[model samples]
Target chain A: MYSRDEFFLLIEDLSLLPAISPSCRSAFDKMEDPEASLIGIGHLIEEDPGLASRLIKVANSPFYPYSGKVGSVREALVRLGLETTRGVILTTSLFDRIRGEAGVYALWQHSLAVSMISRNIAGHLRMPYPDEVALAGLLHDIGKIPYFMHDASEMHRSISDVDPGRPDYKREKEAFGMDHMEIGEHLTISWRFPSIVCAPIRWHHNPAKSPEADRTVVRIVALGDLIASAYGLGHPEFPFVDGDILQLTEELNLLGAEVTSLLTDFLYDRDLIVQRSHDVF
Target chain B: MARMMKVELATTEDGEMIVQDVHDMLGRLLVRAPRRIDPELKRMLLARGIQEVFIPDQSSGDAEYERQIVEQERDAIRKRFSRLQDTPDNKRIVEIFIRAFEVFHAEKGKIPPV
Candidate 1:
C-alpha cells in the first residue's frame, strides 16, 4: 500500500505530476488577483487559440443565458464571471493534461454531471459563490486521477472490488493507505486552489465533517454527487451510500417537498444535461 | 409496446428495436427500422453522428406495464442505495428517487400523468 508520505512526495515534486501549461498557470494567477481585469485574462487565454475557442464555446453553451452572443474570449470571460471562469479553466486544463488515459473520459463525464447538478442546485438555493460550488463538484473526484495515472488496470480493479457497504474511498484507503479525498485535498491545496473550492473535494463523502464555514456548500456538493449517481450518470461500477435526506434538507433550509420539486425539474432536464456534457467534452 | 418514444440513442439498451429508419445528411440509408440495436449497431449509429432515435416505448401501456417500469426503476434506485441500512430516513430518500422517476416518465408521456 502507498503511504501518505509517498502521496505528498508525488504532489510536492512538480516534475513528477501532470504539468499545467505555463500560460494556463499564469492565467490562473491573474484570475485570483483582485486587481486583474477581464481584458488581461482574455489576452492571456488568447495565447492558446484552442483554449480561447473552448472558452468561447463554453460561453455559448446552454448553461449561460447569453448563448450565441459571446463573440470573443474577453466576452466569454466576462460572461462566465471570474469564479466560473476559474472553474472552467481549471477543469478543462487538468482534464486535458490526461485526456486519453484509461477511465479519464468517463471520469470527466461524471464530473460534468456533478458540476452541472451542483450549479443548478446552487442556483435554486441562491447560495453564495455558486460558481465555486460548481468548481468543487467538477474537481471532487480528482483524487482518483493519480491512481489511474499510476496503473490504469489496477485502479479499475480497486474501484470495482469495493464492497457495497463501503464508500469507494474506504477501498482506496485499504489499497493506498490514503483515500481520494485526502489526496485531492493535498493536490488542490498544492495547486493553490482556494479553500472554498478544495473543501468539497476533501469532504464530499462526509459533509458533516467539513469545516463550519464551508459545511453548507460542502453539503450541497455532496447532495449533487449523490443525485448524479442516482440518475445513472456515475461510473457504472461505483455504488453510493444513502444520504440522510431529512438532515440534508433541514440543514439546507429546504423542505423535503422543495427538494422533490427541484429533483423533478432535474429529471425533466436530464436529457438537456446529457447533451450539454456531450457538447462540452 | 404501444407508443413510440423519442429517446437518447446512447441510453438505448441492447435488443431494443428501432421504430424508424435512420438516414445520413446525404439521404443515404444507414439503418432500417424494426431493427434491434445491439452494442455494435449503437456504435455505428453514434459514429455516424446520430444522437437521438425513435424507439417503441416499451414502458408505455396498461397498468401492468407501468407497474413493471416502476418496479425496474425502483430496483435500480434501491441498488444505488443498497449500502445504507434499512432505516426510516433511507426509505424516505429512496422513495424520493422513485417518485421523481415516476414523475419524469409521466411528464414525458410514457405513462399516465401523475
Candidate 2:
C-alpha cells in the first residue's frame, strides 16, 4: 500500500560499535563503584580515538567555557562533569554515524528542541534525572533515521505528517519489517543502555492509561512529548498532541501553571538547541 | 508469574503494554517495536512473554478505527518482520526477545504462541 525504502538508519552497526566514549573510559577507570559507573565504558571509548578528540571538541564548545586551556582527557572530564562528558562523547559518536538529508540538520534542531523542552518540563516538575529526560527527548525520534533507510535527506521532509501510527510507520515496517522504536530499543539494549531510557521508548508513543496515571517515568516522557508539541518545533510525524494535552493534564491532576512554567524553560533553551544543531552536529 | 495469553498485539493499546512488558522483562535484550500498536497496524508484539503475529482485531475497533485500514498495514508489517527473521542479526535478535519473555515472565502468565 506504501512505497518506501527503509535504510535501517537507527540500527547501530554492530560491527562499528566503539566500546564506549573517552571521558567514560577515564572516569570508569577511576571509579570504585560498578553500578553507578563502569571501567569498560571508558576503556571502550578510549578505543575510539575519534571519541577522545570529540571530548576536547565538546569541552571547547561554549557550553563549558574553561578559563585556562587545560588540555587532557582527564582535565576535559573535570571541566565537563563525568556524566556530561560521557554524554558528549556518546552524542558525538552517534552524530558521526548519522548521514541524512540537508534537512537532517533541521531535524536535529527539532530533536534538540524536544530535548530542551523535556529537561525544562522535568525540572519545573522537580522530576529527577533531568539530563536523561533531555537526552531521551533529543533522541526520541532517532528511530526515524533508518526509516529513511540511508536514502537522500529529502526522504525525511518528503514524509508527510502521515499518521505514523497509521501508514508511515506501518509502511516502514513493511519495508524494513521493524519500526524505528523497535530498532532504537534494540540498539540501546545491544549497547547496554539503562532501563530508564528503554522503558520510556516503549511507552513514549502510546502511554498506558492505568500505569501512566500512576508511574512518574511514564508521565515524564509522555509529558515531554506534549511539551515538545506545544513548543511548536516540529517532529511532524509525531502525534499532533493539542487537545489531548488538556485532557491529560486533568487526568494527571496537573496544574496549568506547571505547564506554563515548562514552556518558559523551553523557550529559554531554544537557543542552545538551535546552536547545538548547527555547531555540535 | 503465569505469563498471560502471549500479550496480544492487535491494537495500539495492546502494542504499548505488550512491548513495555516484554522490554521490562527482556533486560538487556531489545524487544521494542516502534510501530504504534493499533488495530490493523503491521506489528509484532511479544506480550506476556508470548510472540504473537497480530492481525488487528475488528471486534475491538470502536468509532475511530476499524478493520479496513488495520488489515492492509498488518500484512505489510508481517512481510517486513518475516524478512528480518531471515537475516542473521535479526534471527538471533528475535530469539533473544522470545527467550527474554520466557525467562523473565515465566511465572507471570504465559501468552500462547501465534
Candidate 3:
C-alpha cells in the first residue's frame, strides 16, 4: 500500500503526468489578456500547427455542431468561446499525453459524457458559467489518469472492481492512500483553474460536503456524474445512482418526470455522444 | 414516424430472433441482429443492468401520435412540477435539457440505428 506522500513522489517521477503544452500554455495566457484580440489568440494557436489542426477538428465535432466546417483556429475560437476553446486545447493535449495508456479511451469517453451532461445541467439551471462547469466535468476524473500511467493493470483492476453502491473513492483511498478527487484537485490547482472548476472536480462525488459558495455548481456536477453513470456511458464498474444522488435531486427540486425525460433524451443521444467522444479523443 | 415501445430483455427466450441490434448507453453493440439471442447473450445483457430495450413500434408508426405522446408527457411534467415557484434557474434547466435532447435527436436521425 503506497502512503499518500509516497504516491505524490511517484506522481512526480512519472513521465506521463499531464503537463500543459508550451504552445497551449502560451495560447491560454494570451487569451487571458483582457485586450487580447481573437486574431492574436488565433495566431498563438496557429504557432503550433498540430494544436491548431486539433482545435479545428474539435470545433467541427458534434460538441460544437456548427452548420459548416470550421476552417481555422480563429473560427473555432470565435464559435466555441475563449473558455471552451482553452478547454478543447487542454483536453486534447491531455489526451495526447495519455493516448496509449490502458483505459485512457474509456476515461476520455466518460469525461466527455460528464462534460456534456454538466453543460446541460448548467444550462437547465440557468447558470451564468455553463462552459466553465462543462470544462470542470471533463477534467473531474483526471486524477485517475496518473494511476493509469504508473500502473495500468492495477488501475484497470480497481475500475473493474468498482462497486456502485459504495463510493469508489474509499476503495481508492484504501488501495493508494488517496482518491482521484484529491489528486485531481491538486492537479487543477497546479493548472491554475478557478476555484469554481476545482471545487466540482474535488466534491462531485459528495456535493453536500462542498464549500457553501461552490455547492450549487458542485451539486450540478454531482448530478451530472450520476446521470452519466446511470446511463452506463463509459466504464461500467461504477455505481449509477446512490442515496446522495437521490437526495441531491430532491434538493434541486428536479421532478421524477423530468428525470425520466432526461434519461430518455440521454438514451436517444447516446450514439452521437459516443461518436463525438471518439472524434475528440 | 416512429413510436417507442419497451421490450423486456429478461423475458426473451433462446432462438427468438432480434429484429434490431441492441446497444448499451455508450453505444457499444451489445447484440447483433440476424441472429437469435441465446441464454448466454441474455445473461450478458442482464449482467450489464439492461432490464429492457426501447424500440420503435412497428404496428402503429403514427408520427403525429408519437409527437402527441411526447408533448403530453412534457405537459404533465410541467403541470406536476408547476406548484413549485417558478425560477429562472428551473426554467433554464428544463430548456437546456430540451435543447440537448433536440440536438441528440437530430444527430441520431442522421445515422441509421445500429
Candidate 4:
C-alpha cells in the first residue's frame, strides 16, 4: 500500500495544481457574492469563447426545458439562474481545462451522468440545494483526472477489471495510498469551493469513514457512480460495497426507485455529452 | 452594570418594536419563537414541513454602510498586471478575474471588496 502522504502528494504534484491564474483565484473569492454569481460565471464563460459555445449547445439541447432555443449566454443564465448556471459552468470548465485527450472523453461523460443522477435524486428526496448536489456529483470523481493524467494506460487497465459487489477499489486506494475522491476533494478545496461540496467528493466512496462526508450528497454520487461504473458509461473500473449504499440511503432518507430513475436519465444524457466532448477548450 | 440591547422585528407585512432595554434578559442567540403564539406563520411552516427559512439580507434600521469593493478593481487589475512582465497566463488570469468582477459590479451596481 502506498503511504497516505505519498498518495496525497501525487495529487499535489498535478501540473495544473499551482497555476491559480488570476481568473480562477478571483472566481474562488467571488464565490461569496450572493447576488451575481451566475452573472459572474456567465461573464467568465463569455471570456472563454469556446466554453461559451459549448454551454449554449448544452443549454439548447433537448434534455433541458427551454421556451425556445437558447441563443446566448444571457439567455442561458436567465434560464438556469445563478446557482445552477454556476454549477454547470464550473463543471464544464474543469472537464475542458484539466484533462488530456486520451482518456478524458469517457470520464467527462461519466461525471455528467453522475451529476444528472445526483441532482434528480436530490430533488426527489427533497434535499436542500439540488444544484449544489449536482455540482458535488460533477466533482466527485475528480481525483481520477489527475490519476489519469499521471498515468493513462494504468487506469485503462484497472477499468477493465472493476466490480463493486467485492470492493476492489479499496485495494487500489491502499496501493496508491489515496483514491480519486480524495484527490478530487483536494483540488476542489484548493479551488476554494464550499465545504458542503468538498465533503461529498471526498466521502462518496467510503461515506461512513470519510471525514467530511455529507450523507445525502455522498450517497447520491456513490449510487450514481455505481450505475455509471457498472454500465461502462463514463465508467471507471472500481468496485463499491452494496450494503454501504443501503446504509447511506437510509441515512439520507432516499429511496432506491428515485435513484434508479435518476440513473436512467443520467445514462441518456451521458450519451449526448460524451459525443459532444470536443466542443470545449 | 449590564448594557441593555434593544431588539426589534419589522417586515413588509407586520412588525413589533420592543423598546425596553433587555440587559440581562436578551438571549445570546435567536431562540425559536413560541409556536401557538404565531398561529399563522406556524401553520404555514407545518405545511411546508421545512422548519427554517434562510433570509440572506439582515438589515436593522441602524446606520447603513455603503458597499465599496468595485471602485478599485479596475485599478487593482491594471496595477497587478503592471508587475507581471515575467508571465503571460498570469496576465490572462488576472484579466479574466477583472472581467468577472466587472460583471459583478454591473449586476450589483457596486463593486465588491478587494
Candidate of highest DockQ: 1
lDDT of each: 0.74, 0.48, 0.67, 0.53
The better-scoring model by TM-score among 1 and 3 is 1
For each of the candidates, the C-alpha root-mean-square deviation to the true structure, in angstroms, is 5.9, 19.7, 8.3, 24.4
| Global local distance difference test of model 3 | 0.67
Residue lDDT tens for model 2, A179-226: 656666666555455566655555565555324332555556666665
Task: Order the candidate numbers by lDDT, best to worst.
Answer: 1, 3, 4, 2
lDDT of 4 at A168: 34
Candidate 4 versus the native: TM-score? 0.56
Better of 1 and 3 by DockQ: 1
> Cα deviation of A208 in candidate 3 (Å)?
0.7
How far out, in Å, is residue B6 in model 1? 12
> How would you encode candidate 2's per-residue C-alpha lDDT over B1-114 as one tens digit per residue?
322222223223534333232332224333453344554332222211122333333343332232333333333223223422255644443333233323322222333222
Residue A46 displacement in candidate 1 (angstroms): 0.8
Worst 10 residues of 1 chain A by lDDT: A10-19
How many Å off is the CA of B12 in candidate 2?
34
State in Å the error of residue A237, model 4.
Answer: 2.7
Per-candidate DockQ values are 0.27, 0.01, 0.07, 0.01
Instruction: List runs of model 2 lying over 4 Å from the truth.
Output: A1-50, A56-72, A75-87, A148-171, A209-214, A236-239, A247-253, B1-114
* lDDT string, candidate 3, A12-104, tens digits: 643232376778878978877999999999999899998888888888987654588889888988888887786677767766776765446
Candidate 3 Cα deviation (angstroms), residue B113: 18
Q: How big is the positional error of residue A134 in model 1, measured in Å on the Cα after superposition?
A: 1.6
